[model samples]
Target: MSDERSYPTGIGTSTTDRIQLLGLDLADEVLGKVSFGELAYWLATKRRPTPGQLRVFEAALVSLADHGYTPTAIAARMTYYSAPESIQGAIASGLLGGGSRFLGVTEDTGQFLAASIAALGDTSGYSEDDWDAVARDVLEKAKSEGRKVPGLGHPVHKQGDPRTPVMFQIAREAEVFGPHLSLFEAIGRVHPEVLGRTLPLNGAGVAGASLADAGLPLGLLRGFALLARTAGLIGHLAEEQQHPVGPAIYAEVDRNATYVPPAP
Candidate 1:
């Protein structure tokens, strides 16, 4: 038996005199040449995206980057107030809040749309009406199961999500609008009939669909969301350092808290 092992990775490697990322010089070739968005997609897919794909991917990143005073931001700010020394902790605290209700919708909606589309074996011939029919079936099945259709409603944007159409426009212009997006848009159109009321296809959900169409992996959908949110949380922390609202938020909640007796 030989006591030798080899580990191979195409991502990054360090040598005595240089560092290489994706088999390119980190300092000379990749430093100022590649945009962060492009770099992210390349890293994820191990292939550089075309200009159109880059636009859609970056658009998704921007869409999920920030939403004012969301629970994730509040958690980060609150944690910062308590432990100013640990910015990492504050950022992690915010990211920890990404679940089914908050920032997890991107993954939920993507997975839902992807799975639904996968069930239809040959969608190469699917038409607009066919897509709508598929969307109706998906919505009906979800409703029958008593499950809220992900990406179909927004708590804040009752009339519509402003980010949804913008993302759609970007994807359409990029020409990367694949079945994931087509099906999602179909759901938006037909959901009112299925659910008895119209709900906007939200921004996060659109981001997911857009990303999926952009050739990213299904399992990494939520990771992309978190990557975008990392930028947002950093912004919140930066604002906290200047204006310091975390303490006020904590005090406001603390002051309003009330206790009641437990029932036997």
Candidate 2:
């Protein structure tokens, strides 16, 4: 019965010499015909992307590829320094930090936007104020309950995330700009009126909106984030080889730590 509990997925399969993905032969049918971004979409969704969807997916992947000196990159570098033999360990450690608002905000924002849209189902005649009110109410309620609204603010780029505008443009060009994107934009506009501050669109917010608009599954957003950053993590690890910054980062953090002496 243990073997009877096998799980099934349409993702991919491998044999001795052949690999297949989404029913297409990997080497013969897919290798040169598709970009990695398009292949990525296929692996996740079991379908090919429209040119527009490919653009947005590519943008999201590139946008999150590497934020210089991010915690994830730092962790990857440090892990590489400590365990030079285990590059995979470094990558894994970096990805492990990507929950909540860290690097996983793209997933959080997508899920949040999906839920918000679902809650406002059948908006046949919702006026601008009505939709805005609904959004503000939702935001306020989440705030009152001390919930972290994913993908709104950023630590740096106070004016706006440079990536956000580009992602929005890509979505617009792709014609995938839908309610989720609108909801995030609306939230941005109504933020000052409702929350007494402006929280402009960040990259994660754009990622969420774009993926949702592009019709990707909400549950897969986190996986997408990890995949996107894996490219960046690989870059960081490679850089750590020639120009090692991991030790310096570690030493700087160590210097900043205020040790509390244990009771004698």
* Candidate that would win on lDDT: 1
The root-mean-square deviation over C-alpha atoms between each candidate and the true structure, in angstroms, is 1.4, 2.6
Which lDDT value does model 1 have at 109? Answer: 88
lDDT on C-alpha atoms for all candidate structures: 0.92, 0.84
Off by over 4 Å in 1: 261-264
* Model 2 Cα lDDT, one tens digit per residue, 1-264: 365676786888999999988888989998888888898887778778889888888888888888888888888889999999999999999999888867688888988888888867776566667767767977898889988678888999888899888887889888987788877877877878777888778997789778888878889988888998999999989889999987887889899999899999
Residue 73 accuracy (lDDT) in model 1: 96
Q: How close is candidate 1 to the true structure, as a TM-score?
A: 0.96
lDDT score, candidate 2, position 33: 89
